[model samples]
Target: MLAIDGSFLDFKQLDLLALRQTPVHRLDPRAKVLTTLCFIICVVSFDRYQISAMLPFLIYPAVLMAVGDLPFGYIMRKIVIVIPFALMIGLFNPIFDRQVLMQIGSLDIWGGWISCISILIRAILTASAAIILVAITGFPAICEALEKLKMPQTFAVQLLFLYRYIFVLTDEGVRTARARQLRTFGKRGLGIRHFGSLVGHLLLRTWERAERIHMAMLARGFAGEIHSTRRQSHFGRTELLFMGGWISLFILLRLYNAPQLLGGLFTGTMP
Candidate 1:
């Protein structure tokens, strides 16, 4: 019963944070990763005062979040944690660039603030998209995606192996600690010397396991690369149409007049 309960708990937690099985997840990891990179590049390429231009770019991330069924609040919270880093770098702009680029009656709007806001928006969009991508795609898919993208075969394979064995290693460490606890009884747990010894033992065990796995792989002809038999994924017409329509619309708004369009929409000229 205890074992069953533990397994159930682990399964539930994994579902809460683990990757979902959906169309987005089934997409070729390499392609999805590349598209995400392109999206971020497009967003960052816009100059300051590009709020309207950024709107259409928002569609890509939004559709991914919605269709992917990702945990939006969890991803947004991660974004909030990283906001302080951006704020630290951008806060200097207001002090350094004192010249006002625009004015509205008594309020002097500095170019620094505009640039800072631009930086903040780009940072948020890029980070949020990245977190969502990883959350929806899982670590193995990411490693596989990297592998398929012509990344160094050795490096990508190492990541794949590392992720696969991490949990096993962790479980071994936990069991060892429990055994130590049972033996120590009233003794101080995890003292410096004891901790050092435990770490050394864990390292030796991990090395031995790796060696055994390598030998097993050699026996089966690893051939210096890991191979997966999963079918390749491709984007359909719907995805292409969505990407094209949004890219063209955003570029048009950016080149023409973004702020005017936004103002007109707010003022009821266009929805």
Candidate 2:
């Protein structure tokens, strides 16, 4: 049998992790979703140069990963894929803002470098939190949780379909590419002369596949909204405690220069 594609394998791994019986996976999805939203907010709210303030926010994702039994390397690799996008957007900071912010021995730390690193740190923290949330709560449960929290129905429905269509799209792309490869006998595949026709055929094929899926859903009485067989979960005491604890921690981290404070306490040096 052909080995599954690596990208699809990672996707399946996350979905499978959500199906595990860990406590984090079993939390009311609404709670997990809201907490993750808060975590992202706290991390993103830091100043463009406030790298020190961002360090404490790492605790939230770390806890979730540990509690959810998530693989550190797998999640970090997913996070690595996002770093270049952040760098692409923020890389000019050092060139534009070159004021020295600090000195260590013979080295000078530029404010722009600090700010650029800050952006990268914040990106990793926020992205990892999101990945951990999906790993624990899964996509469908998150949609249901959002609906329960009164997210606009249209937006929620669109989100659900968008997430589901990704797999469909990837599958179609891989199969199309594989067929092209087979026909070309590994010498050349889908040359520029044939690119336009292949592009059209790929779209047409994916559309037909989606149409058949829609018809199948209709035959099975799929309503305008996606429904789940999972029982409705409530934000009870456990969820309330979970949300409260994290929010409090996030608030504290947001309001304090945690790194300086802790570093001073430990080493008698203050920034």
Candidate 3:
């Protein structure tokens, strides 16, 4: 019960972080969204064996978190939770690709190992960028930005609804689980046999609750469009500079391995 409730709180905390009055938070959402999109594209564009070249991308998220005043530990924990999926996706690379890619002294490093590490690094960088985007911009503003960026209204509305109702669904699940625990004694009805019934109850309860919410929204003049109380800011010079500068840097990093070049220069091996 506590785990479920805690997870819900953690999920909602991003909105709370977005409420802070930081420079990053004050920028137009479209600028941040575009910059983050470019960052993800650059991070994923690296070759499978390319690792060091991607390390510099970490600077984007780190700088954003600092300027946005987001809590590093909280964001790191959220990133860590989804890492296992990336790990599982690349776990078998070593078994199938045994060809050696590099030699370090006596030990041989295989292509699979390098690719696996590359996948993990890409996952971390992309996940951190996305989490920081939400922590600073909030989901509503992101959806609004997407709508302005030519994303279909229906798609944007559905996406926003999905994000919003996730909390409701999680809350419903928690209540159902608690009710099950209370009615049973000493794990009598807590077995896997009752799992299906508990899920069924949760679904019914959630459906009814969703109907109520929809009715309330309709009564309050919700006409398939989300409105915000915050004043909408124009995409001004600051936004242009913010997006342009980061995009230029992303292109530079994508084209050249700065780390490798610096290492060569330092070792008098520049060619």
Candidate 4:
């Protein structure tokens, strides 16, 4: 018999917050994780002018945030922050299209505007789902879910370490900022002398701390792997039901046109 080699795979990182736990947190990270993937796939599959058909899709995020008991205002705030990026990219569509797709009273709307709306909606749906997924499930759980779904362990470990140290480094940054403030009583904050020393010192301190942390981990028996044998999240009937309901809704929206009152009227189709 020929022997198979397992040495070709490379190491990968884990996302720390993906492994967190809450009400929405504990319900099968795999399901929550996969649902987000499905959401993206569905949103991106829509035609550029597929606006009204996509409105029903909002129910997915709404139900998720509500049932998952996520922070409503916080999720909305995150959406706001990311919207500008989509708008900046999508705004150009109107200037090019100028083709009047529809007429409403005195104003005529171009297909470009409609397409822009579709792109923006797709962006919001994709970004919001991602944010909510992270907000509810956290990063570590996501990595764990990925691993459980057959992702490489090395990558998962990297994601874990990256997230673990990001906060640590951020705290270090705060301290460094405080020290800089103490020295900048009269000088401009970003003057040449102050800026050079600040950059130099922060880099030195970060490297020193990283080395120390690595040593500490090695001392505590952190071998080549960042191993944790925690129980993986289980998928039960509830999770199956949750995933199925949304999936069915997605398929239904994909196959037939959405109802008029649900925003389909805006697109002039209600099949």
Candidate 5:
């Protein structure tokens, strides 16, 4: 499927991006994963009506994007597609809770609209942080980082295998499509009648391909665990500093309102 190709290409691009030797990329994947998890939790913990407070949270992703050399345009585009889903989480607040909060100029501002905007802001902040993390760390390293963090072995192995075989599955599907296309000979072949048989064949092929992969892994002594040779599990001074600094910042941001403080800087109203 064309969609399959597109999905594979997007992942390939992110994987290539992760191979760069930037400082952010060189840091322990645990640092990034832990920081990102904390960031997401903090951002989501904000109330449904706290938008401006979430602004300062953008610093995490912005700095990571710069340090990791990730493409801002790519991240923004992804957030755009995901925005509608996030918006829906609070989009109906205005209709159900129409009690007017205040009057903005000639318009009555509803609490629902404010809450909706807040959810969207939180969504953007959290989504951008995740995208930046994956672009910098790649899925493989993240899995390794999770394993090191004592995540369940079964979950990590499942993730690694899915990533490993998705390519093979896609390739086989593409070949199947090409063969069908060639046999069709400029005719309308893949009609509803052929759909069942076509899907069944693809399923059979996928099973066979999966069995082959299982055998290969067994031959290579997979031993039911996905081993990553790329990252050594170690806690050095730099990693400690990196973790402590960002975590402290997250705690501080959670305790204080950075956005309001910045906003009141020139008005002599800062606390």
Candidate 6:
């Protein structure tokens, strides 16, 4: 029960963070969304063996987190949770491709190893950017931004509903688990046989609760779109600068390997 509650709180921390009054949080959501999309594209566009080139993209998320007043440790923890999935994606790289790509001192690194490490770096960069985006902009605003950017209304509404009901589903599951625990002490109701029944009950309860909520919303005159109490923001000059600056930086990083150029300059290796 405690674990369920703790996980729920942790999951909702991004929404809590989004309520802050920082400059990053105040930018038009469209700007942040587009900038983040550009960042992800640049980071993932690198060749499979390119690692150092992608390191420069980390600055984007770092700046956002600092300016947005987001908790670094909390965001890092969230990113760590997704790292295992990234690892799984790249796990077989080294086994399939064994050609040597680089040599450092006595050790030779294979192309597959480099590609695998590149995937890990890409995962960290992209994941951090995404989490920071949600922490500052919130999911609702993001969905709204998508709608404004010409996404289908149905698709955006579906995304918004999916995000909103995740909490509802989680709450239902937590309550069901607690009730089961109270009814059966220790390992009595914890068997695999009881698991299916618990899930069935939770699903039925959630379905009923959803129906009631839907009826209430309909009665309240909820249209196809959900509206926010917050004042609507426009795409102003500040948003333009914010989006343009980051996109320009991303383009620069994509075209030139900043780290390699700096190393060359320091070592007098530039022609």
Scored by TM-score, the top model is 3
Q: What lDDT score belongs to each candidate, Candidate 1 first? A: 0.73, 0.86, 0.90, 0.75, 0.83, 0.90
- Candidate 2's displacement at residue 118, Å, is 0.9
Better of 4 and 5 by TM-score: 5
Candidate 4 structure lDDT: 0.75
lDDT of 3 by residue, 1-271 (tens): 8976897789988899999999999999999999999999999988999999999888899999999988989999999977999999889998888999999999999898889999999999999999999999999899889988999888888888899889878887888787888888657785887998888888888789879988999999999876666457789999999999999999999999989998999998974
lDDT of 6 by residue, 114-157 (tens): 89999999999999999999999999999889988999878987
lDDT for model 6, please: 0.90
Better of 2 and 6 by lDDT: 6
The lowest-lDDT stretch of 10 consecutive residues in candidate 1 is 7-16
Instruction: List, residue by residue over 109-141, the lDDT tens digit for candidate 5.
Output: 888998888888888888888878888888888
Return the TM-score for each candidate structure: 0.65, 0.87, 0.90, 0.76, 0.83, 0.88
The residue-by-residue lDDT of candidate 1 on 159-198, one tens digit each, is: 8787678668767877887788788886887588898999
TM-score of model number 4? 0.76
Candidate number that wins on lDDT, 1 or 4: 4
What residue pairs are clashing in model 2?
A: none
Candidate 1 lDDT (Cα, 0 to 1) = 0.73
* Candidate 6 or 2, higher TM-score: 6
Ranking by lDDT: 3, 6, 2, 5, 4, 1
181, model 4: CA deviation in Å? Answer: 7.0
Runs with alpha carbons beyond 4 Å of true place in candidate 3: 181-193, 221-230
What TM-score does candidate 6 reach? Answer: 0.88
List the pairs of residues colliding in candidate 1.
Answer: none
- After TM-score superposition, the amount by which residue 67's alpha carbon in candidate 1 deviates from its true location, in angstroms, is 2.0
Tens digits of per-residue lDDT for model 2, 68-179: 8899999998898889999987899999998999999989888999999998998899899999999999998898888889998788878888888877777777787777
